[model samples]
Target chain A: MKKKLVLYLLFPISFVACDNPAPEKKTEKIHLEKVNSNTDILAENPEIKLVGSRGFSYDFNDERFMQFYDLPVKNLHISIVDDQQHIQRLAMDLPKDKEAVNTLKTQLNKAYGQPGEDAGNDFSAFEEGDVLVWKGKDRLIAMITSKDFATAAKIEKAPKIDILFVKPEETNN
Target chain B: MNKLYTGALLGLAIAASSCGSKKIKIESINNRQQLDSVIALLPKTQVKVDSIPVRVLYMHLKGDFTFYGQPVKEFSIQTKDEQLQACTFDIEKGASDVLQQLENENGTGFKEYSNPILSWSTLPKKIQFSVQDFDGDLLTLSNKEKAAISLYFNNPVNNRITNIYKEIPPVTTTNDYQLEVDNSECGYRLYVNDFLVIDHAGARTLGVTADINPYLVKGKQQKVTVELLPGNDYDGNPRNRLHLESVVHVALKKSSKRSMFSSVVFDFRTPNADSMVREDAHSSRYIRASKFYGQLSAKVDHPFETDAVPYELPCYAAAVTDIRTIPDAKEKILAHYRKLQQAYLEKDSLQLEKLLYPLEKNLQTAWYWSKPIDGQTRWTNIMDKAREARDVKLEENVVLYTTPDGHFAKLLPAVYNKNPAFYLSKEDGFYPLDYYVNIDKNGDVQFAID
Candidate 1:
């Protein structure tokens, strides 16, 4: 009888002792490429050179005011997700050169016909700059003239054109 | 042996079950005072704000400011024989018309002219002038045109020039000049005597207003020029076409303790697009890069002294130089910016409050002395912004700018150029939160609220 009592008591304890159950749900880690580091960005876009970097953002050297069809590229900025190693955004800063801006408009018109309905909503920084947008099946290209109005009332810096290329799904509009 | 084994197993199971069932005693307070008494025994966790000596200029700027990129070369002024002080004439020629004539039934008329040559530097402040009549009523003129009428005072004794004009108020030391600008289509820069006093650029449909006293030179002709900046449309094209909504309005008002009434000293406004322009003339004043539509210039004579307190401040350049002397100052500053970015990313209000304490305190002291404190809501909004910042990263380069008096300084992320680095992400996208930070006497980088 004592042995029978021991078996009954041990049965509940044995159920509690079975601690391991089905594993809990976990987030699946994501992996991305062409944005691992400055080296990777340089390797992917051989046309440009790296200038500086901080965290997941990288600046490209464009000292000579490199031209991509009349838009004098002053510099390039690339942002990435550090943990996932994914490219979040890429922007090319254009010089505040009006002549160049005029020329680029002509060049863009020649290359990709007249622009369609306003696609300025693709980027967050499109509030003040003159914007030209081109939409393709899988890609969206936008040219923006950005301004720095945060300074005092006296210092008016010329607005620089920024050309942004991104996947269609990445944009809000 | 079996009984002893069963007894030991039972003891182990009971011990384990008892360990899991241990209950924590939670005391419930019945009233606020009871809770307060219980909390009085705890240590204080509130951050203490360190008071630092600094001079502040209370400047308030409000306006409908926009940027429609254009240079100030579109406007000019000249005085004949150098009799009048330079920039003494205020010109209000329409963008498309340099000469607009007015005629009335009373046979009273005046030919409007721009770039007029005048010689009247020695004339008294209250010179007589005449106005043209339109339909038995006074022919209304823009403040700029009215102010420019002074240039026509060739001979003060001439009755024709003095018939219907109102006398300009004399300027005094305590007088303040309030400047207001409204531009819906583009941004602009306002220059007082070639010194840039307002740069409202790259924005649309904004009105800016501020006191022009600090920027004005007393006893000198105040030259106020607005240069139109190029703006973009909904599709990012240059906004060169005039719509019903497009308009530009600029006015300057003069007031003082000695006078109960504030008189407009300068004004300029685009004619109502709905009434003035048809399909044919739409592009006349709205033309991109057109000199006619891109520049506005005016001049007013302020013969009294202005208060210099706004211009005078402690040297901020020295503070910047001193901060640079610290070991790894650049790294430290970058770290500070990163710390802020991280704090916002994590929605850490305590850390943000600690970091922003100096700024909040200075602002309270400078701007909110008479108001009640409501920091909780402010902190909540700040934390919400932090959570909305999304995926933000600190840029490598930091740029510093200082006030001319060297009393205040602000740091900017090179990526943002003139703006600070902390951008609050929103449903529409990201916009920067204005922060002017400096290294205090204690060598800690804190917000400079000026």
Candidate 2:
């Protein structure tokens, strides 16, 4: 009789234990060019700031950022979570100089694996054309769009970094 | 057994919670005795913090007598959601007067604020208190505004004798200048035409004098009002109670042809006949006579025809003391210009540096450049500008703009010489820069620019 009582209690207890499992912590992937695993980088580094938003422009003599290269990056737009001061997106206006662009591309090639092959990858993250992209396992993608080679010193017009990155999945795990 | 112990500990931790995380703070100043007593009477606990007195003594001016209220720093509790809660004060017993927070005419906060003393004559002195923003949720009071507050007041602490002055001014004439005031333990401000002439602190109503001529224009009678500011008047106490004296006007004998004086001086003292022998050095003259307490105030009258020139420093008379007044200012300026060229041609830095001219206090000067490369905020050394000038050479056609009185001129180089055109000032002599090079009449540098 005692054995039957123990058996009945053991079956229900085992069933209840198996019914629930601990939730796994999900991680988000963010890699562009030489930059991979930006999870902690975005959390720690302060967002870059630009005074003007109407159009793209950069000045070499701007004393705002002493650490960054003074010449190439024309402008930047930082995405923050809601009204809280949490940075989500980081975009930079690439330099007009071809040499600087090539150097940046070389670094990106090492990290994102030689850019995607998709032709005119404006909206899609497919591998083609001059639009290079790297897709992640967790549905996060980093995209880069390169223009025809122009010498950094001879670039007559000031250029805008209009390329944008979007999250593939609706829920940012 | 260990598992049971862990569960028991967790249950205990869940049951035991902190009393609170928010509190109110109050700081007492000025009247510490009454403030301490009031705070002692109020309820404050572990969760409810009330008062924290920072020990800092305020500096007092020697002869000032306005009794501004003691500021009390008070803060309302802030909730978890970051909202300020309403806070009020409770006074068990003490003398008190609330200083209302200064607000603009529209009742909004004003940038320029003075700690205002308010009195409810009808209310009892002990329970006087003010509520700061009863409906608003934001508690952003400035340190000055916070400390400008007074929570309570106790009466006996501020010992004051009210209605002490009985014998006051009744009917007085212009010639009847003597005003005998009762000998009180406090001092008073004597105002004529709303201007404070006498802020006197003395024991007896004995001989004291001041010249009130500065407040009067020629031929116009001034209305006088006097206020007695006591040393210990705060918290609606009887100490600040001012028994305003009666208003009286002194008339002057009309003159058909009064001299229009440029400068006037009034001697409030009862001048002795012996001292009046030689001419009074001070051009100020007393046209009206009046006395308060032991002091007399002098009123000087100037002629209506002559315009009164305000006092200015670095003036022509005051600056040109080293030599007799220059008969021809234009000749002197031109001669100085030629000397300046000689110094520059010689590349003589020392001589160029010495191109300094004496300036009287408040000397008026200007530049000839249309978009003058200069604006002087303070006294600037002319030598510095001379040194900054890259190349100094004489230009053709020196343009001279003479002063209104022709006593001074400003010299500018030829207009086409686009170099930082040195249009130095010409006051008695050529000043290579602005005011500092100009010496006062005493041959001392006392020049300043506005």
TM-score leader: 1
Predicted candidate 2 versus true structure: per-residue lDDT over B32-75, tens digit per residue: 32222223324343124434334322211111011222322332
Cα lDDT of model 1 by residue, B127-197, tens digit: 21232221111222332332133322121221211211222121223456777887765555565544445
DockQ of 2: 0.00
TM-score of 2: 0.18
What tens-digit string does per-residue lDDT give for candidate 1 at A82-133?
4313454556554455556567667767766666545456553544655567
The segments of candidate 1 whose C-alpha lies over 4 angstroms from its true place after superposition are A1-173, B1-181, B184-186, B189-235, B238-333, B370-420, B426-431, B441-444
In candidate 2, position B277 carries an lDDT of 25
Best by DockQ: 1
